[model samples]
Each structure stands twice: as C-alpha cells, then as structure tokens.
Target: MENRPQPFHITLVRHGESVGNAEARWQGQADYPLTDTGRAQARALAERWKNENAKFDLLISSPLIRTKETSEIIAATLNVTVEFDPLWLERDNGDFSGLTAHEVRQNFTHPQFSTPYDPVGGDGEGDWELFLRAGQALQSLLKREPARYLIVSHGGLLNQFMHAVIGVAPQANNSGTRFRFGNTAFAQLMYYPHQHRWAIDRINDHAHWKDTD
Candidate 1:
C-alpha cells in the first residue's frame, strides 16, 4: 500500500475597516467596532466566496469585535459556525493601542517606531514572538484535521501567520513579498501532509471590492 498525502485548504481573511482604520490609528489589542463600509465589505467577501463555490468545514476568528462581526457576516453567508479563538488575536500593542502612527512615532523612542518588524517596546509583542505564536496556533488548529478552513483576523496577525507558515525571516530589512493586505483582503493556502508544507494559492486578493464598485 502506498501512503497518500492528505490535503487541506486554508483561507485567511482580514477584517474590514474599523474606526481605527479610518483614523489611521494603530488598533492593537483594542476592541473597536467595524464601520458601515466595513460591514458592506464583509458582505461582499461572502458574495465572492459564494460565487467562487468555496466551501469550508471550519470557520475560526479572533475574539476582537471587528473580526467577530466580520466572521458573523461571513459565517451567515457560508452557513458555517464560527469558533472564536484568542490565539488568532492581534498582537498586543500595550500602551500604543489607540495611538496614530504619528503619535506612536512621537511617543516611542524605540526603533520599532521606525521599523515595525523589529519589536515594540513596553508590554507589546515582538514580531518574532508573534510569528512563533502564529505558527503554534496554526499547528494546533491543524490537529483537528479539518479538510477546509476559514480564518478571520487582523492584517498584522495574518502577516505573522504567513511568515510563520512560509518560514520567512522576521527581520525589518527582509522586505519580503510585495503584497498589501487591504481591508477585507483574503488569501488562500493549501497544506500537503505528505510534504509537511503549505502553498499559497492566493494572497491579499480583493476582487470582491472591485466587484462591488
């Protein structure tokens, strides 16, 4: 008998715009509600998923209000139940939670203010640390053995997860892939059990936005 590889598909969706997004504020560890435009973006995401005939056995989201709200909208469209998980939560920004980029630069003298991929000072999370967490959380979730899954979270968290999965170096100078994750940006990946590897099918895809426009 030959050993066959088990294949699983994973989709990551960044939550839509939040009040912080509009204000250009850093929304770390803050539970902010989604904007009206954000809700419409989530609906559009669902429509795109439906149009593509996408199906998933599992739906997971961060405990943040914006993510939960976005997940709720998506889950309703896909008829899937959402399992809120703190492991997918955004990195803790500590005192910088509600500060704008300009304010953060003015307040923090740390190099992180200039190069965010380095590490934030105070009680905030380090880029490398968050990368490890994303790796661990993803490993744990895969243990459930779902064939297909959807995850809703913040852009930074999703980027960390991708870095972990792809074994990308967590360095400020890495300047890795040139992909921008706009609001409601979605990515598709596939895991191969035989190779113990994951492949990116899509990244930062936002065709849904164009469709709605």
Candidate 2:
C-alpha cells in the first residue's frame, strides 16, 4: 500500500464589497450584506474557482454575513458545504468601528491605533493577538482535516493572517506578497507540515474579472 501525500492546499479569499466597505467606513464586526457589485464579485469568484477545477475538501468562513454569503456562493459552485466560525471574523476596531480609513487615521491616532503589536485602543483585541489566534485556528483546522480548504474572511483579517503565516510585518512592503485583494479576489497558500510553515503560492488572483473590465 502506498502512503498518500499530505494535502495542504489552502485558499484565502476576502469577502466582496459590503455597504460599509463601499462607503469607506470601518466594518469591524459590523454585519453588512453584499452590494450588487459584491454579489457579482462573488459570482465571478465562483466561476473562477470552477474553471480552475481544483477540488476543495472544506469551505470555511467568518460568521459575518458578508463573508458567509461570499463563501456560500463559492461553495455552491464547488458543490460543497461551508462551516462558519466567529474566530475568522474581522478585528474589532472598538470605537473606530464604522469610521472611514481617513477618519481612523486623522482622529483616532492613539499610540496603539495602527500597530497590531499593541493593545487595540486598550479595549479590543490587539492585532498581534488576532494574528496569533488566526494562526492557531488555521493550524487546528488543518490538523483535524489535512485537506484542501478555502477560507473566506475580511480584508483586514486576511491581511493579518497572511502576515503571520509568511513571517512578514505590515511595514515590510516588498519583503512579502502584498495582497490588495479586490472583491472576490483569491490567494493561495501551501502549508508544509514538515517545516511547519505556510508559503504563499499566489496573491490577488482575479482572473475571472479580467475580461469584464
């Protein structure tokens, strides 16, 4: 009998544009439905995954409505079911919730504001803490299943996870894959169990929407 090779393919996808996202407001822990364009983006992602023909053993998403919806769309195309988890939700921005990026920078610039390494506003979970939790969660999921998986989450959350898994900080611009994932864009990562490391395979792969523009 031949031993099967370890399955370690993981795809991370940011949810489509929500109302707060389109409005340029902070959407941390805010539940918003996908906009019309967001729905289209979800469909586009589904079609792209279908064309790729890669089989995913599991589909996981943040409990947030936007991510859940997006994951559902992709899962439908893949003919799979999705598992929802709150741990995958975006960081809680605390008082900065529902504020625009400019607003967050201009008025809320506490010493700990933008630095994930510090306590978030001395109230919410620090960015580093979220990163650690995400890493742990991903590891646990993979250990339990050890198969190809898809994770649909928010941009901020996904970015943090990417930084954690790739050993890159936010300021390390050119050192790692900087993913500006548009609505429904997908990124791939491979987890090598031997090295216990996750490697970025692709970033912001939006081939499905290329011809639409």
Candidate 3:
C-alpha cells in the first residue's frame, strides 16, 4: 500500500431539540435538558448510527445538558465513553439567556443582538468568541489523528466549526456561509494530516429524519 496519511474522520452531530427549542427560547449557554421529543430524537439517532455500524474511537460532547443527554444516548449505543468539552458548547447569549425572542427584543436595543449580526464586543457572545471556541475545539481534535470522532454539540458551534475548518470568515454576511443545522442533524468531515486540511463530505444533513418527521 502507498504511504499515505491516514484520514481523521469526524462525524459532527447537533444535539436534539431541547425545551428551549420546543419553546423557541434563547438557550445561549444555559443548560436545558432534552424535551420528550428531543429524547425520542436522540434514540432515533442512536438507532440510525447503530444500523450504519458507525464506530468511533472517541466521543465528545458539549457540557450543556442537552448535548450531554444526546451524547450519552448515542455513546451508549456506540459503546464509547464520552469526553465533555466546553469548547463545543453553544454560543454564550450573555444578557439574552433564557429569554424568548419577544423578550429579547424588548430588552436589547439593537435588532441584531439576538442574531449573528451583532459585533464581537456585544454583551452576549459575538461571532469572534464563538469562532474562537470552535478553533480551540478543532485544535484539540487535531491532536488525535487517524481516528474516528463522534461529536455531540449545538447548532451554532457546529456552524462555527464548519466555518473554521473551511478557513472562512465567521461573518455570515461577508463569507456567505450561513449554515443551518436542524435538531439531530449531522455533518461528516475528514482531516488529511499530511495536507493539514479538512474535507467535508456532508453538511448539516438531517435526511434520516425526513420520512420520520
């Protein structure tokens, strides 16, 4: 066989719906356990991965409870121990945590406060802070090579990670890489150690739940 670099495979999974998701509340960095539907979604995701025979050397999850619960279920099915990484946690909402959209609108002066348009210096987490967290997570993952990693995380972090891996600016308006990851959606990426590059085979795929949903 040719002496080629072994690829580091990463399967990125966004945690299932949380009470905040179902209620349309600002989750920020708050810990919200999975809702009943969210638990069911995790179970289905576990079954889907099991059926596909997806194996991982390491499983990482955000410290947030929603991701923790999702990772626990999937790791149980995969028989892998989970390592909690706060870097994979969701974006910090600062003053907006645990509030509804209407509430946020009532409180914040600017319209972009709740969204990604706000600057990095905003009271809550701006794009730069979130992108830095994703960068830290990616750097940590690079230390482990030639292995499969299954990550259970949040939507914003997933988006930030994808942008980081692809080496693009985190500004959605400028870079035009605004990705939407629905609950329980996933992306598949491979890292070429020799080239120091990442290849995304899939992005924000939730096809497994298409028919079920």
For model 1, what is the alpha-carbon lDDT of residue 5? 62
Better of 2 and 3 by lDDT: 3
Would you estimate the TM-scores of all the predictions? 0.90, 0.84, 0.90
Relative to the true structure, how large is the alpha-carbon lDDT of every model?
0.83, 0.77, 0.83
RMSD of each: 2.7, 3.3, 2.7
Model 1: how far residue 183 lies from native, Å: 1.0
TM-score ranking, high to low? 3, 1, 2
User: Least accurate stretch of 10 residues (summed lDDT) in model 2?
Assistant: 170-179
Tell me how many clashing residue pairs each candidate has: 0, 0, 0
Candidate 3 lDDT over residue span 16-122, tens digit each? 88989888888988888999878888889889888989888999999999999999988888899899988888888887888888887787676432434565224
- The residue pairs in collision within model 3 are none
Segments of candidate 1 deviating more than 4 angstroms: 1-3, 112-121, 172-179, 211-213
